[model samples]
Target: MTRSAPRSQAAELELPGLVRDRVREGRAKAAATRARRHAEAEIAEESPVARVLVDVPLAHLDRPFDYAVPVAMAADARPGVRVKVRFAGQDVDGFLLARTTQTTHQGRLQPLRRVVSAEPVLSPKIADLAAEVAERYAGTRADVLRLAVPPRHATTEKEPSPPAGPAEPWTVSVAASAWAGHDPAEAYLHHLADGGSPRAVWQAAAGSVWPLLLAHAVAATAASGRGALVVVPDGKDVARLDAALRQVLGEGRHVALTADAGPARRYRDFLAVSRGAVKVAVGTRAAAFAPVHDLGLVALWDDGDDALAEPRAPYPHAREVLLLRAEREGAAALVGGFARTVEADHLVRAGWAHQIRPTRALARERLTVAIAGASDFDLERDPFARVSRVPREAHETIRAGVATGPVLLQTPRRGYAAALACETCRAPARCGACRGPLHLTGATTPPECGWCGRVEEAWTCAACGGRGLRAPVLGDARTAEELGRIFPGVPVVTSSGERVRASVPDRPAIVVATPGAEPVAERGYAAVLLLDTWLLLGRPDLRTDEEALRRWSNAVGLVRPGGRALAVGDPALPALQALLRWDQPGFARREAEARAEAHLPPASRLATITGEAGAVDDALTLLALPAGGEVLGPVPHEGGRDSEEWRAVVRAPRAHATALSSALGELQRVRSARKLDPVRVQVDPPSL
Candidate 1:
């Protein structure tokens, strides 16, 4: 019995060791199996080294990495093809940028896991453009590539590309008369038809058929056997441009690429452009990267529209993208809008592009403009012109015009009483809970804080302790209600925000719309009322005057020839004067000069860094200011998502813009490498 007990105790002691040995043996076998499989995986004999752009958004890891291409993926692993690869011991998606005979990488390279698809979805030109855009915006290439390339859909990728349409010969005669109004317009078309790159900032005349004109330009380029890209501000513009393109270039010559088209449709349209099925691509901002085969012309409409500025990281402006594309591909550029922007004027002033606009005499004949309180006679006649939101002259104009055609009333805000003030003291009302501006969502609903959505059950004036509230700023809904009451039995329609209408009937009616939401009238409005001019011009923004003029001009452009546009502002205001005289270019020049003197954008380069206080401080510490550069504030900013964040502004001469961007980019890279929180770096932000 003693001997048996000793044997059992020895067996128990050996059990754990035997189990460990079995597990070690299994691991060794698995390792051997993996090694054998890796060794057996054949590498491509020719051009075995593949440079891949992994889909890592880390700024520090933005560059391409070397990977050995497996023999099985040789045919499929072409440049611009999507592939799965082992990156940092994890499977990741990447684009095969190029293949080389050998790589400079000295370490043992990992082979690609598999090719995502054999299709070369990303074009070399687009890849280059994306990289350039990233560098210019101080963003990672992966971020820009995400914008350039649509997400892959296996079904759509498997589908065959649409057959290319037969080429159509184009000539200047096709659109010569269409361009006769503006001097050199015919010349621009001829240059496009002749395959010459001419850069022009075109100021579209009032009531001008701009869609058709742009379509003519695209057709001219297409006739030259080169492609054209046109980017507008919104989906409504896309629809108009699409119709115009069909009218001029016929069907199947172009495809519209917009996020609204759904993923499958958007991807299909992108594939069509990449496969050379279509030569013309028109859409919103995302279409700026459309890979047109042999690009010839790149045009953008309404470059100042906020929609053209991407809201995502890096926040690239479509105008800059088109400009970059034109410079890179030697493509003609046309920056056309109802009103000229300072940036557009800079293009002309820099001799990079010429201005195409009608003579002052022609412009005056095309547009009839008036300003409330412009002259002593107007003020004396109305007696309340300066104090009234809708003056006697404006009301009379609307009353008379409604008999002829539609009348457009453009409001700067969209909701019902967008701002409230104390009636006794004229001080803006604020919520006690959050100190946010209180606004009425409707006539019956109580006022609520815009920022925190806290209901102000009983709000009192902070200054003067007034109990009554008065709407100092009226939105489209309130304006519409007032207009409806003023003009009884006259059909009134409101368009703004998410419920914006594309067009209104030509019949007699009153259309109250916010800026950028005005609906097109078939024959054009007989009269347009630019209401609440102070709302746009009074904003605490650097581009207040410019943006006000833009919105006013857009509304005025919807009026028919000889139609009246009455703006409710001091006639002497520069923006109003520009509209009154139909001289946007002159206004743009003067504004640009003023900005230049102030060392603002176009004349200088500016960047805004906003984030948490510590993050911002870290970025500032890392920032290497260029020569002649200045840093403006570390001010408390409420613009960031986090309430505790701050903002800093960096400024430099225009010549050192690239240097500033590079410095900011390096700061981001360092922060990323150190695993620090990121700060938003925006070059030439739309607003200050």
Candidate 2:
């Protein structure tokens, strides 16, 4: 699984209907009450409100512990304030989610030493959501809150300057006059500012440069006298969105919320949002909590990306955050993306938002194709069935495309050299010291395994007597090497990460890139050799087909009309037919139906129970009931002799997920009474 990097910043807050009349009355009454109580004792106010900070270290036991509220700073101790409180005799940070006349304290309570900041960090909504996330993920509230609210950025402070970024163009799906029809994206922008009440989601396609789309929407919403929040996938997306927002919304009117900003800068942005200095909030995942006076709409881009899922404790996702906030605050939510998730599709199916999309037929006019597969079409098929290698038919396409422009080779892995096998034996050579797969570093050097730091000497081929080896599972380097050899006179540029080509203009050269790393051709690629299509299409996971289609669509989108795109695969499959006809939307609809029939994700919520084989069995046996559905897998682990973990899956209606989750939490609590917590609950996991 792709573990996404943390965003620059994000936060959660729940604002009560705090009004002017209430603040004044509450303050005056609190002040008078404090004065009367202080007259007699310096020891302690017998029943003073102690703003206790508690974290749910354990999911079922997510209750706040008792703490003392010192008298000197009573007025400043508002809910959402972080303070140093002594818990278990050690000072720990806690957010005051709420205050009450009492706490269930049998032991003596410790007084809060100092309020961390006068500014409020925890919103009541976020605080509640933090607890909710804990319950759902079977994790401690404290753990969830730690990720939801990092310690340092929670404080109120100002910074000298904002961070800088590289000049990478945002990913955008340029459409024709779908804009001539009033440009819902642009109109949505206008309504954001004219808001009397808040709520709405601006649905869009994948690769639509949503940061820019959202910035426009926010600026429009702000212009209409409402605040808007734009949440995207990562820091890179944040930069593009932030820049676009500043350009359109104007600098002073907007604030960027991301973890990448320095502590002081983040605090400043938070304060600006809290104080309503910024009407348009543009940020990464954490920016969902836009502290605006009156929210207009909450826009989340690429809602499907795992980056939207919080990684800390509770593992709450941004889509849920946006949903809850939108529901509670009446803010419009626009969960836009280039590619639609089944969850997103469900939202449209449920009438949450009208499903939006780019016209593929129109898109196809600009798209061209050249497909080769395992049929009469294939000239030279791979022995191992890897598509990325240079097959003879691929050679023909490349030669033709190269004469006009560059040829692109897309592979799965990125490396100089990926696989190594004994030349004589053909079996994967291993280091005797560590049992790890060995790599051949140099002709004279010993083979080493990366896993155990183990090296092997006199390590001859197991199958044959050959001491040397060859790369079996080909990588970008191998492809580049072969391409270099085939077209020796041509300049071969390899793109992977930071040094990748910004744009792939029309050029007579071979560009080799790993998936997701392929740059757009400046003019256009003469041909795209989609190698290893089967490896991508045939993954064991349910998403294999959907994911493979996405890869194909993205590549096709970059191809110029009448340009060549040869996808080498089992042409007999319908996926190939769909590609031949450019029928992505049709294919997606069909795949969704199949998944629904199979009771898979997007159709039913999935709760995966994984642990040691024995532990999983015991836990599954204990889960007697799931409110909305049936239990699915206590299935065996696939691949490898040492794969000891087994899994049990629970599939329930999307509506029943919470109740089922709650039941699991309750079961966990009951089990805790009998034994330690055994099963873990992960909701809407990226994959099973």
Candidate 3:
């Protein structure tokens, strides 16, 4: 029995061992195959050292690293092309910056994993600009590149870009009449047309003809066989500018690059610009980095709009990017807006850019502005003029204007009742569950928590223990509802948030809109009513007054030449006076002087460092401040989810800005090296 063991049982016992042996052999063969291929790959002899900028966001690894390029990838591994390289034992995406014969790296260099694309998306100009922006903002280069270049779409990349062609003669003549009162503007266009770079800060007159004015400048630049780029605030402005460009320059001469165009279209437009297939690029914030060939002019509208600021690490402003490009590329620059910003005024005062503004008489003829509470008649007619959101004078103006054409009512907020307070005690109503402010979405809707989105069926005032609620502030929805009742039989249109209307028919209608969401009228608005002016002026930010005046001027600038604008605010306020006199440049000059005297920004550089308490402490400890640099806080920061988070502000004079940014960047590198928690470093944040 022992000699004749069961044959079936013996075969089954050997199956497990046989399977294990086969798997081991297969793995070993695969490993050997990879090793043999790596050893056999040929390295390029000439310019073998390829400098690659890895996509890692860590501050410590921000600079380009040298890697050996294999012969197979040498042709496709051109500068500005995308590639993958071994970085810290992991294959990471990178941009090939350059190639050289020598090597600064003493250790053996690793070969590139593979070439991602042969198409050169990152232009040398854009690469340098990204580096400058990162250094200026105290951010890692990779972070800036993320904003500079859109993600690659393989399908779009595979499509061949149209061949570069001769510049087309503009179809429509430059509308020189649009700049009739602006002598400097006319001269600026002529200079651009003659291949001269001139920087100017243009103050647009009241009307919707600004697009045409910009088109004239862009066309003037294109006539010199140079490219132009225009950055606006949002997609609406993009559409308007795109239409104007086509009308002036003809079809296929320009492209609109925007996030709203979908990733594929955006990437396709970007490639078209990079390949010199289009000479002009117009879009929102990201258009600041459009790789226009032979860049000649960089212009931006409404630079003060919050939408122009990048809401990411580094937080570069579109205006700053254009300024940088204009300086680096020897290109003309135009910072144009209906209302001037202190930064733009600073450029004029510094003699870096000239101001192009209409004469006082011209401005007054084009616009008619008044403050609701300024006149004695207003106070007499409505005793509640000081407290009423819509004073009697504004109401009357709206009523009379609606009879002629569309009337635009600009509100500060967007919801029905953005904030609610107890009627009896005047205490703000809050949700018991979240302690968040209560608001109403509609007249019949119950109160709900703004932060948590929880309906508060039984909300109470914490300060006064009252259940009753009243809206201290009215939003666009509520204003539209009230206007409907006031002007019976008149159609009421509302525009705000995601439901914003681009344009309204030139008819007898009342259009209520939030700031930045006002619709363009076909024949221009007959009247512009800026309601609740105090809400804008009451913000706690440092730019409150400047921003408030900017908003009011933008609204008032929409009125027809003989039309009127009435704002509900104190007449004595500087912002209101500026609106009445149509003197944004004067107001901006005063604001710049005030900020310089107070050592606040535009006169100085400010960097905000925010993170967890311990992380902030660590950064501050590692920071080596430049001479005259100062730190403001380690105050509790409300930006993060953790209550223990803190914020510190580092400030320096304009002369020492670079040094301060360098020091902050070094400290960030140290934190990264130590593997500490990440902290945000934002230089010149739009708000402080």
* Most accurate candidate by TM-score: 3
Can you list the residue pairs that collide in candidate 3? none
Report how far residue 297 has shifted in candidate 1, in Å.
0.2
Tens digits of per-residue lDDT for model 3, 1-688: 4586598656646679888677678889999999767653778887998999999989889999999988878888899999999999899999999989988899888998888999988999999999999888888889988988899999999898775444446522345666777746777887898899999999988874788789889989888889999999999999989888777777778899999999999999999998888878999998999999999999999999999999988889999999999999999999999999999999999999998988777787887887876553456654444544576787799889989999999989998998888887877787888788888999999999999999988776778777888888888899889889989999999999999899999999999999888898988999998888878988889999999989888887888877888887778899899888888999999999999998888999999999888889888889999999999988888655457779999899999989988888888888888999888999999998
Worst 10 residues of 1 by lDDT: 376-385
Q: What is the per-residue lDDT of model 2 for residues 1-688, given as tens digits with 9 covering 90 to 100?
A: 9875444211112224455456668779999988855642232454455555464354444566555665666666788888777666677677776656776777666666667776676777667766666666655667766655544553345333242222222211221222322234434444444563433333333223445456655655555657777787777567667677766555566777888887777777777666555566777776765555677778887676767877654457888777777776787778765455666666766777654444555444444555665553333543544433556788888888889887887876566545577665668777666667776444455657868866766677656678776666566766777788898787677777565664656778888877666776756677777777776765787677766766665555455545777787777777777677665546666877888888876777777776777777777777756666787767775644477767777878867777777766666666666665465566667765
The ten-residue window of minimal lDDT in model 3 covers 164-173
Q: Identify the runs in model 1 with alpha carbons over 4 angstroms from their true place.
A: 1-40, 166-171, 374-388, 452-467, 639-643
> Residue 462 lDDT in model 3?
77
| Whole-model Cα lDDT of every candidate shown, in order | 0.88, 0.64, 0.87
- Compose the digit string of candidate 1's lDDT tens values, residues 559-657: 987788998877778899999988899999999999999999999989999988899988888899999999998988965455787999999999999
Candidates 2 and 3, the one with greater lDDT: 3
**C-alpha positional error of residue 233 in candidate 1 after TM-score superposition, expressed in Å:** 0.9
| lDDT pick, better of 1 and 3 | 1
> What is the lDDT ranking, best to worst?
1, 3, 2
